[model samples]
Target: MGTMAELFAGLLEGVSEAVAESTSLQGNHLLELAVPDDAWRQVLCVTYRLERRADVPANSFRLSAQASTPLPFLVQVMTEDQQLINQVDFNGGPPAAAISGSLTSYNGQILHIRMSLDGNPLVFHLDLGQPASAALSGRLLAFTLASRPLPATPENEQWPRSVTRQAFVLGYEDPVTGQITPPCRTMPPALSSSRVRQAFLDLTNLGIRSPKVFPLLSVPTDGAAAQAFRDALGNVDTDAVVAEMHQGRQLTATRTGSGAYTFRFVPDARYTGPRLLLVETYQLTSVPLSYGPGRVIKTFTLLPGERTTMRVSSYRRSSQSIQSTSSVLDSTSDESEREFEQAVTAEQGNSAESSKSFEYNAQASASAKGSWGWGSASASVSGGISGSNSSARQEFAKNLTSAVGKNAARASARREVTVDTSMDMKLEEGEESAVERTIENINTSRTLNFLFRQMNQEYAAVLHLVDVRVAFFSGHSESREEVPLAELDSLLDRVLNVPRTAEVRRQILDLVGATRDLTGNTHPGFVRTQAPDGTELAPAVDPTYTSDYTTPDGRTITLPGIVTAAERHVMRTDGVTVDAFLGEGQGLDAYSTGLQEQALRAQAADNLLKEREADRLQIALEIARDGDQKRAEAFRTLFMPTQIVNQIDHAAVNTAPVNGKPSS
Candidate 1:
């Protein structure tokens, strides 16, 4: 205190000592805030308004504070729309957003939060750092952290900072293509044990055991859920059942709606680091149990995510299995009966005897004729009688006397009687012959029967699918301003949604084209055709609504050519026409063979033409040589007349004047 500097220093030391004592006392007082049945509790709420820091994705924000000591705490984040986004680190530890439990800090640490942001204000609630009485110690204990907000123009604006947003995408990166494949927007309906049990029960009750689920795998997997199927199905091969599900089976599934997305990069002052993209991939398998097979989705978690393009793997879209049966029965029967009978008898004999004979003869004759005409008439009459007598004299005389008396009183008895007797006679003959056939009760019976039975069964199945494809083909999108963490879920939903608009549009166009074709309104003027020489054919004639619709091979022939060919075929008269009947199966094969044979015949005909031309050429060459030789001989004979005269004279001299006189 001897000088002014000493005096000022001494005063400052005293003041500093007093101030330190007061701060200690205040801290002790705060620690004593806990009272029995009335512990101290406090809630802190803060609102933050995020502003665009640059022209980039600025949807991320950070909340940070310093904890004086470890404590039990709860923190909540919300958006302007009051949408709750749960975020927790358990007092500055690892995040535990998926866990639903109270959070406790282990030791004093720095409290921090990082999350997505949006255009709206963010509200944060901190419920921590309050002193309460210890049950055993009967004394107050405190764990506290203090934070204060900075003022801004807006009521919700605070000093919390925001930066470029970071997003994570899950997909598969193709090893071969060096591209990323996004997850499928739609997944098959989950098959659970309960559902399987229900389905099995239904099948059993309905007696429709042929029904099957498709694309089902047959494998074992970890977890009690996999074992649940066994309890439902008894005495059946679980693995076999699951494996058979996808064999020759069909299913119908619809894809949910989604949009196409792409990603591009542009330099942004606000973007500090690249966003995260996880390329995850998985395979679907089946696990067999008692009741039925179940689906198991296996995923690989350690795959790297450094690709730019991705593809999606998917199951088949549709499948089918067809089964059919046919049967036939035919039967016939017949019965019949008949009967007949016959008989015949004959006799022959010869005998000889002697006897006296008497004979009386008488004869009479009469004739009369008359003719009349207009101018002439003629008549004539004649009569005569004749008689024979027996050998007995009395009988002969009686007959003769009666005859004479009747014939005429002037008959003068012109009767003649004679008797004759034979003493010996010879005869040769058989005794008797008889034949009897008692077929009078003839009877015959017949029976016939025929039966035919047949049965046919058929089964067929087919399944096909294309890999998962993008329904939308647009580019990726990003907001320039911050997007709230609460709204991030919606964005992801949008990305996963797949729409049927593109497919529907294609189907509509196809249907329209088909309709036009059916109506014969396919714009005939626009239908172009080409000739064999590759020149464009003339435009189609006026639309003639003839019954002559186009056949499958109609396009193969020109209109005029086909017409002429048909006409020629119709006009043919010399060719043999054969009508054949063909049944199914082998008959069809034989028919096809016949058609091939016909084509071969046509080819042979063409070859025959070439052969004929060759033969004609050979014949023509020979004829030309002969004609050339003959022409040369004729020219020699005509040009050399002296040779002809000399030849004639020599011939005459050698011939001895042809009958001793060389005349003329």
Candidate 2:
């Protein structure tokens, strides 16, 4: 039983060897004949002239084989543990074959091959760059191997197992040297065309296209060179349009230094028409730098249906340093004079710093103002002391004060004045020239000088009074003290009242007369007095009445009517002063009696009106019935009897007291 088991095992091994050799013959094989110790896994294909053998079908042969199904020719190299290292494939057709054209060997060694058609095994040997006596021999054994049948025993009732092939090494070299590198004994694993197609699909989904998916190289940040490179990107037609089957379209591109940028394209269904995407790039420079006078650098990218962000930055340089240098030199002396020079230099340095700071602020302010259509102007003056011991504060104050004064004076002197001149001329000839008339008209209308003269006089008076008041008040001393109310009132009264202001009083009276004149008959009773200025003066009276009193009989009386005529007469004259006096005459008495009679009549009428209307009605009826006769009778009854009696008594007294002439 032991020999039988051994014989079976040997038979199976022989079949496996034959199967392996047959598969190698059908596939394109890679042979690792030799390798240096330090060599990495680098493979190369070398072509050489193959020497033809006389009896081997001209060193090339074609064989035709048939299988139940179309079969692929696969070749692989692996270890005994089934870890595959290399693989290759050949077209499974009798005519599609790889011809061996080279007799390449491992290192400087040669290989020997023998072939037989009688089903006998072929043998090969490798020299390994060593002596021929020390060469290794490999047998190409052959036997038909069939799939093992299932065992009937329950313990062995399993499916057939796949056999794992092992890789054979022709020779090896020292690990320390790279010389004598050899071809791989087994083919590398075949790359799937399906896998390559799937990789390409993934890239397409990522919006990668030809020319758009190129690798980006890193660059430097030197300003000009970087700008040049960016400009060049605009001229490059490296962008490609990619359409996705599922997702929307997109554009992918890479810059030299920066990373990749992807732009989404509008979907085909939604796209109305063709569209292009434009991209631009710019470099933002440091604050100290500026773009040239009128030139700016920009980069642009144009693509179809894509969105991209362009970095744009402008550059500018500060003018502070140059401006400061020029300003400092122009404003100062060149010669050094003792410590003063040092102090001046230090001051100039500080000024320069301050100016630079101010310039920045001014620029900002100016920019804002410019946008708003407004502008601003500013000037500053700084002064420094010659001695180090002097305080800067004191010098600054002095300078500020002087500057203010100078500016104020300049403004005052620069006052805008409009002047007019006029000339008056008699006609020197028969007819006046138009030019002469115009000149005359201009001269006649020249009133500015007069107005200015008047204004100057008034201004001088005001200033003189102000000065006097200021002096009297003792330089604002009075401002610190609070005056008593009574004292203030007295001062106001003194300022307001003046006894010698008779002329002013006369003028005021004249104004009152004129106002009364304008009021017409409403002021008919106003009497005008003649003043020394030949002006007629009238007593001031308020034309507007506050209240009116009515009698019981409905007779209205105003306050002005309340004053007696005697009182008005007293007011009109100055205590009966003599003017071209003749004597104290009866004329005044007659006038007085006449005035009194008129007053009596008016009073009587007013009294009668105050009585009951019934009484007035009865009297009026009686008078109307008897006509003038009844009125005469009533008057006689009330006055004639008394007067008649007085006259009779006077006659009797005259008759009794007088002699014979008295009776006459």
Candidate 3:
């Protein structure tokens, strides 16, 4: 059993060659047309029964047809002017149309005729064995039947077969454009029915059962060489000495139970060492035979019970681009102690502090001399003695005593009325005050603008900071006072009670705040408020916003949508060809990104497998060649037996005597 396409193609295999020979012998010029020669044969065969007959008129033939099928069939008919005629539906046989006419030859291959179909006169032209347009313009009539599975049979033991309707086209022109389409040969036909196609499949199941080869070790039954070989074998584990060889081609070895082994031993026989062996190999392959357009037969041979595998193929070229990306991130940190120190330094400026102090001291001293006072007392005593002279007689004696007493009294009474006074005073006062502050300036306008403009969607909206200001102030203030004499309230009060004491008092003051004036030289009435270091305005809508609008069809348009559409349009315009854009076709849903990714992965896997297979085959070939070389080298190194050595010397003689005669 075979597919309908295969049967028809095989039946018309030699028709083109036959027609060519006939036309050449007749010495006629062939006409180029749109229909294939095999197409003509297929149509003629299914539509009518053809046979060689001498009774027919020269270069003429009658037309008639009766076609049927067990399964549903589709029939279509078109006139020469592209008008459809009778179209029979599948599941019902076509009504037999009574057609009688004589084919009149217009050229070597082009033949025309007027047939009476039902009642109308229809014209038909057949271009035999000539080039045709991709789509034939002449009348087209075809019958198609669904494929049916074949019954069980020995020929299909390994692979099943099915019978399908043959594939053929009478016209090649597009019905709408009246232009020729691509050749039908580019399309895949029904499955093949050839037996050779299953060879690879059968090989997968076939195993190498008990492959044998000549003994690796051959020597005398009983000798030192044989004993040595035996001892070597005894020392090694027999199971461990496994030899596994993989070859790409068939291996040659002695068949099991084929014949007896042979050997001969003589004295001083050198043992043969281990060596590799090489064998020439062969394989079975396929060769394709193409008889006509869309007709191919692959010739091959396979083992018993193996059948061909049907294959269908369609080829097309398509390409796309894939993108892959890699990303990385880096993070860094500093010690917390260092960060704290920096913050403290920035907040508090390092500067000298303020101080104030007050000090006061006083001292008084007095001294007197008594020498003048003693002299005055002596004069008073003398006056007192003169007043007492009235009593003269006793006065002389009293005068002496009085003189002594007056002298003592004078010395004692000489009290000096001298007085002296001195005073010393010291006063000290000090005051100090200071104000320290820090101001920091920073700008981030560029970074904010870049983020708003570049990192959003393709058609992002305008964004910016508005009415935003940042200010920081760090300050430090210190005041110091020393009052060691504060406990001396009475002295302090006495000193402070003076008229200039209040005016001489020390006062220190410190003020810490944010001030625009770096120098205190400014007037006290001057305003401290100053202009900001920087300002940021609100963001306005981008000009591209106007491009977004509503369509007349009521579809709302957005900036992002517009941008996406523009990009997609550009990509498609650049990637697609003009012909492809203008030509008719189905949507490219089948070639989506997901499908493309899967296909690429599969292709990569296939390539890797192919490379591995190639490497394995190469290694096998090298092993085979090395085996052969090693065998030859081993034989060269072997020492010949004494008998063979002596024979070689005798044979080397120029003129050796044989049977008492000189032999040349």
Off by over 4 Å in 1: 1-232, 235-507, 510-664
* Model 1, residue 527: C-alpha shift (Å): 24
Worst 10 residues of 3 by lDDT: 356-365
C-alpha TM-scores of all predictions: 0.15, 0.12, 0.13
List model 3 lDDT by residue over 1-664, tens digit each.
Answer: 2243355457656366432110000000000111111211121112211223354444333232333444333333333444333344444456433222222322232333233322223333433322212112132323222222111111211111113212222122233333221111111111011211232122223311221111122222445434443343344322222212111111111111112222221111111111101000101011112221121212222222322332211111111011000000000011211122223222223211000000000000010100000000111111232222212212222222232223222222221111111111122243111121221112211110100000000111111101111110000000101121122222223212244222212100000011111121212111112224535322211222222323232333332101111110000001110010111332236456467679789999999999987986676577577788665444434522233234745655434346658866
lDDT of 1 by residue, 608-627 (tens): 99998798667557757788
**Candidate 1: residue 650 Cα off by (Å):** 99
Off by over 4 Å in 3: 1-63, 67-106, 129-664
For each predicted model, how many residue pairs clash, with residues at least 3 apart or on different chains? 54, 24, 19
Report the number of the highest-TM-score candidate.
Answer: 1
Taking every candidate in turn, the Cα RMSD to the unseen true structure, in Å, is 60.8, 52.4, 67.0
Ranked by lDDT, top first:
2, 3, 1
For residue 144, give model 2's deviation from the true position in Å: 81
Residue-level lDDT tens digits of model 2 in 1-664: 2343345346655554232110000000000111111111111111111112333333221211111222333333222334332233433443222222222222233344222212222222322233211221121111111111111111111111112111111112222231211222100111123322343344434323222111112222456644554454334332322224123222222221122222222221110111100000101000111111111122122222323322211111112222222111111111111112223223334442222222222212212111001011111112111221112222322332232233223322222222122222233354323221111112111121111110000000000000000000100111111122113322222222233223323322222222111112123233224444988553323333222333222333333211111100000000111011112223336676788679889999988777865685677677777778758567445543232235645643223223325445
